[model samples]
Target: MTRHEQQSRLSNVARVDSFSRDTREFVEASMRGDGCLVRVTHASVGSTDIMARRGDYLLHPFPGFVSGYDFIGIVEFIDRPAQSLGLSVGDRVAGVLPGMGAHATRLRVPSSLLVPVPDGLASEDAATLPLDGVTARHALDLLKPSPRALFINGVSGAVGLLAAQLAALDGVRVSGTASPASAALAMQYGAATFDYGDTQWPRQLLDQVGKVDGVIDHTGSRTLNSVVKRNGRIVRTAFGGPVGHQKAATAAGFAKTLVQRFAQPSEVVCSTPMYVAMKRRSYRRDLTKVLELADSGRLKPLDPVVYDVSHYREALDAAGQPASGKKVVLTFGE
Candidate 1:
């Protein structure tokens, strides 16, 4: 497209707004990037977007808090010295905002939070990379797994799949519980699959793949002491609440239990989305490495259930609804 064509498109840019049912307007953000504008082509509606729409995420709700985390887009503008990062206008890029705001056509991304999306990777695929991949890598970095087997509960979900594959890369044999439909795909990512459809999956896992070195629980914090060995690590990055996890952990009597949560620079967290967001600057190395693997067809890429910005409501609803593997995304800047 010519400069005139691009200019005309920018003047009519559309973006999804706050999750508040009352004030959820389709508004526009600044077209200018102050030398840092990202024209988002794909933005993922993650668990945070789903929960925020229900008005239950943040303790104090604001009127116009935009709902989203990860995004992939062409760099439309670059005001600062992004050349150091090999970034320039028209480069495809991916990023995660620590606070909400990626669910828009235009995002004013800082240089520190952005990375060039590898050539040949789809925006939808890269959109899943920043938040979930960073999360999976961060957890493994903390765990430092060695030639041991770990079971990932809820293995078919976005983060679980990434963690499963990454754990395998780090020499941990990965096993995970998934619906029978996704059990094969989970195995493709190197997890020994146990059918979650079985009401007795815990027992099934023990009988088939005895004695896990650790467990990554994404099932609303249900403890796995019944299947995990003593002194084994159980990491929770699930949704809803951790009340069930707390109860299960205490009742099951594990020697040590780890609850991964939002992290700060002064501390480290495991297996949580916020862990990636806060560590965006520090996580650049691993983030680039994973996207490289994706481009080379060596990593398990997320398949997105994409919607246009006009279907924002359906997108949010789909995001909240039960699904396996594929994440819900909103696309703009066509």
Candidate 2:
């Protein structure tokens, strides 16, 4: 369905039959038989890609697959339904996929999964918003009635930073755990920061801000008992453990974290409770809201460190470094 004449190529993350490991290599890929085809300009590098590469993500696929979650691109072709939604060829767009595939040079995705990127927003900034921004929104959404105070774990992280900004916009008091290097950045987003490297950081937060009305915890369950007030809400975004471990181990760890969180007197929830079929309408709406916030300068995205698609390995390595506060992104035709 593509209007472009050139063939499509992608960095395929080929997985073993045993699902024990994966390797990346360039391969030919065709546009989806259905949906619109996008000429990908920039794609995000996230921990999900790292986890998928290691076969540790809970939804890791069998056989082999492409391994990216979000992308920004130009619409090269559109179906009637896409046209009905007001999309046109050459319109800049950004979106996240239900499964991994955005790493490639071209993508065939449903029109409902896509959102228009605002004109003033750079593609690199738009690239980081889809996955993390929606996740942060989901986390905040779980806090019914809207808590007056919020504490986010991993405040320097992609999701945590966006959550901080969104929470601040709602006039919520925000405090979070961050590395010393990222503390000032967190403060810029209206969060009081504590050094997570300190074992007593929980106490530090308690001393400075008292118990919070809610917690968006990406680290694990261990911090919940101390930071969250009794009966406060909890949104669990990540499980505690290494990313390159076995799938069984990852599931086990996730279950254990759930049990621990539920054991608390507080209300425990998950940003993504399960990996069911995606609701394209809801995803498109939330992504649109996040993009608008960024466009209006209400939610400022951190400047990402961009890399060419050819230097993907270096980008991955840089993303894994603990001290690097910036998001890593891959570009095509730059």
Candidate 3:
């Protein structure tokens, strides 16, 4: 069979076992045959179902009742299909996994789905790119904000923060919701921040900024009822549950809107062209801007909280804590 056919077949038949509370044991069993010992470089566990059986070809879960998604890092010792394609040791990769042990020392992954780290970027920093950065880019492409005002809900989240910055760079006037601390950070990135805690935030925004051209709702809650204009666009990223008749009725009046049921990374964001371009130059350019912002004290790299692989359970707990500012990532050889 050709490589694409082989990949198609493998994808159609890949077996995924669901892990309940014992993800470590489950990962050990999954990797028993031909697995590598990849270090868990970085991980995030929120707003996705924690456990599910993942089909082979389709990296996204079969939709049912689930809460959050899990991503993991693993050290690959043996060459696999991904290695043949260019993924390498100490490459620092990240991809969706069956569950949360990704925060541990190492986890097994199917070779084809892994994304390589861009050259000259730290794994800790690179880890933050895949899930959020790629998603933000995709969502913006979908919305196609054109020098207009954009509103981002939950701007403090990883995806939200990146989305705001990307929009601002596109010459869009950006506004976002966050706590006071996160709002301060968002301000430095060129977005006008709104204190969501204030009961009159919606009214304040309407009075201060008027109707927005597009809204990126990361919270997926219907709290935006009064803020969005009748003729504006709304693009929702959070999938709390099915959109019932009430939401359907409310959304019917909008000129253009979309509710993304899943947040999977699009193939467009992971294409060979994008990857090659990133490795050759674009990745460094964008990241250097971020780093320069950091160096100039304009942008902060999400509060530097480090965690060892062994302390993964604690790290996961820390991630769940409120107002933590980004996440506590795993550091190798520390």
Candidate 4:
């Protein structure tokens, strides 16, 4: 096919079968011409993708869906409404979907969900941000009175690293828990790092860094509740547990967790990024701000472990490893 034909072609998606299955080859791509259609260049396989694959994500109850939430791509087609919103054919953009579908070679997404990728940023680097960067920024924004000292649970992870950097840039004293291998990286990003493997780590955090004004808990660990001051806030960046626990996940259970977290007398103001993103409806605004911050060199991008789209299983395996402190990005190369 000619370059023009290829650019205009429909997507070849990474379709997930049932839980814990490898992605099927491609599915037929039909255009409704209702949104901005992009030719995807890079996509990130995050923890949520792993959860969805394990049948752990509540949002992905059914199977046979495409398998990514974040991607960087060039706009191949634009609806009139999307064009009015400032998107155009040939613009390079990055975005997160409310649901799965970004892993495709082509993707149709709402123009409002995407932000223009800065010229200086590479697509691989830009691919790592949309979901995690926005989540970190939004979590920090939820802190009331703004934190003077912040504690991050799981600081070495994707979202945690970004949260640490963003908080540090705001002049907050950041401390966080990480494995021994990743502790230096956490410190390099401006957080005083501790080993989470220690059962007494919370006490260590308090004795060492002192009580924090705010906490961002990505691990869903209740132990983090001890490090925040009485008037401080907490943001729970994720939900569910292991694949076994996720099998038992329910709406009632989710509601109970929310209520229990919120009942902590203002000390724990729980906010999941996906929940907040959907509720606030400010993804485009938040994503644009983070991308601009990255472009301005205020926020450093994580160096991703890149793999071809055909090796998604291997990418997913690498991303699922606990000590893998880098983002796993899949590219659709010629």
Candidate 5:
């Protein structure tokens, strides 16, 4: 569709809040010089540290607490500032920004900040990839699995689930921990599953699966300490508070550190040669594998708790709940 046509179609949809408002606003402000209207394609709410206070920066630096990023829809409405950048309709794009009004009816974004989505992926699924997929890929790269036994503590999460599958492809003996429901889903993704609350769960897992060579601890607890082998490596994603830090230190020793934060897709999507290649080729390969797993009844997209855009607060509330599945996503349509 032409950019004008796309804009006309989007005008009919209702606007809702998204997590990446500031980033989108910043892009939109810049694009206003050229006259572009950006709309969000898809967004997901997962665990983020936007609540923790950093040096002089509120964790959510954006308006409200909208902190998220996703695939965005860009449209050219008139001959304005953004036109000079040469953006066209049907261009697959991705970005990282706050979540709020961005997911609503319309968004204005800078032409320079968007990157093309890989061919063949749906916009909704594409939106989830840049952040969680990249994080999982990068973390697994650090481990460089060569037949090592790996454990993923929260295997049902978007990142954790994808990471477990990726690790299995690398010849790692993947085992995932979760509640019963999530554990079943993890097994479908080719990982051995262990129930999180089994009092003898850790010992049972260790007995059946043996000691793990690496651990991806999304839970941030010391419960799995008994299962890790001596001198084994661990990568943790739950580094939020002082308590989390102390627990990480106690469990993994000084090596317990947060995975290096990756740049927003707006920044790294074009700069990283590997990501560019992955965007062109590997992303499809991996996603196809995920889809195949799903089609063969071996994997499934974690069922999202859906909410209307107007109830963004409720969506966030749902995301915060102790659920075994994935995120609470705000949708414009039922």
Candidate 6:
């Protein structure tokens, strides 16, 4: 089968085990299999983690598994036949795993899953990329937006920013929702800025942009009134947003709403949804592209709001707070 086909097949088959208290064993771990042991320097708290932490995710149990995913750090140990892929004992790297474990000071993971951090990017900034970068790419591939025009709701968020920049690079006209503080940054990456802080942003978007061919929506169920093409496609990335997804799709009136999930061989995440998600053919190339753009300054750098791992409670709290934007990270100090 072709690579895309292979990726699509894997997407339906790659199951993420539901976290039970037993999975808590992953926390306080030192090594796994023959993977490389990393000395994590910084790990970012994603919104999913926040929802799970606060007992808000309907699917997640209270006080859910460790709250992290993407991380940037150095290699501390590598098991025998010492991993190849150009990884060394001191190489700086970035990675994302399917589930929890990144919140800890250190963890063991395969070198195959890691992308080497370029010379000048900060660890905290790099920490923000694994989840956001990969997720943006994954969402867009599923959205398959035309080269004409695209709109991103909640553009100030990290995934939205990366999605805007990546789409803009391919010659799509991009518009994004932002606040006054984040407007300039949003535009710098090539989005026509719209102030979501305005109560009537949907109307405002209708007045300015007219209609877009596709939308990457993070606004939950808040519909885009008369702003999308007759059959515009939409990819909804926010699960814990203000409104439920079915209502969001109904309100927005999208002709094609993409529903994707990373599930198991026999596991059907949602049947009524009648959709499934896929994994990448390879992410090393995507990671390489992101790092190259970051190093050359084509992509704007994120100044992460950092916390020492020793003070994880505060970091977790900060990630749940809206004041921090999308750049909160936890540092593991020397």
lDDT of each: 0.68, 0.76, 0.51, 0.77, 0.52, 0.63
Q: Which 10 consecutive positions of candidate 3 have the poorest summed lDDT? A: 264-273
lDDT winner, 3 or 4 = 4
Please report the candidate that would top lDDT against the real structure. 4
Put down candidate 5 lDDT per residue, 77-195, tens digits, no spaces: 42343345444665545554333234444555555444555455455544445556555665575554443888887787777887887787677889877788677877777888877
Steric clash pairs (candidate 2): none
lDDT of model number 1? 0.68
* Model 3 alpha-carbon miss at residue 187, Å: 1.2
Number of the candidate with higher lDDT, 1 or 3? 1
Model 6: what TM-score? 0.74
Best of the two (3, 5) by TM-score: 3
Which model, 1 or 4, shows the larger TM-score? 4
Clashes of 2: 0
lDDT per residue (tens digit) for residues 20-90 in model 6: 32232223322345578777788887666665554444434445345566788888766554455777889
lDDT of 2: 0.76
* Colliding pairs, model 4: none
Report the C-alpha lDDT of model 2 over 148-246, residue by residue, as the tens digit: 989898888888899988988888999888889889988887788889889998888888888888888865556566777776877777765755554
**What would the per-residue lDDT of candidate 4 be over residues 94-175, giving only the tens digit for each residue?**
9887777888888777787777899898888888888888888878887857799988888888888998888888888898
Give lDDT tens digits, candidate 1, residues 249-291.
Answer: 3323222232222221011225334555566556777788889
Tell me which of candidates 2 and 5 scores higher on lDDT: 2
Error of 3 at 104 (Å): 5.3
- Please rank every candidate by lDDT, starting with the best: 4, 2, 1, 6, 5, 3
Candidate 1 regions with alpha-carbon error over 4 angstroms: 1-25, 29-35, 58-63, 79-81, 197-199, 220-222, 239-273
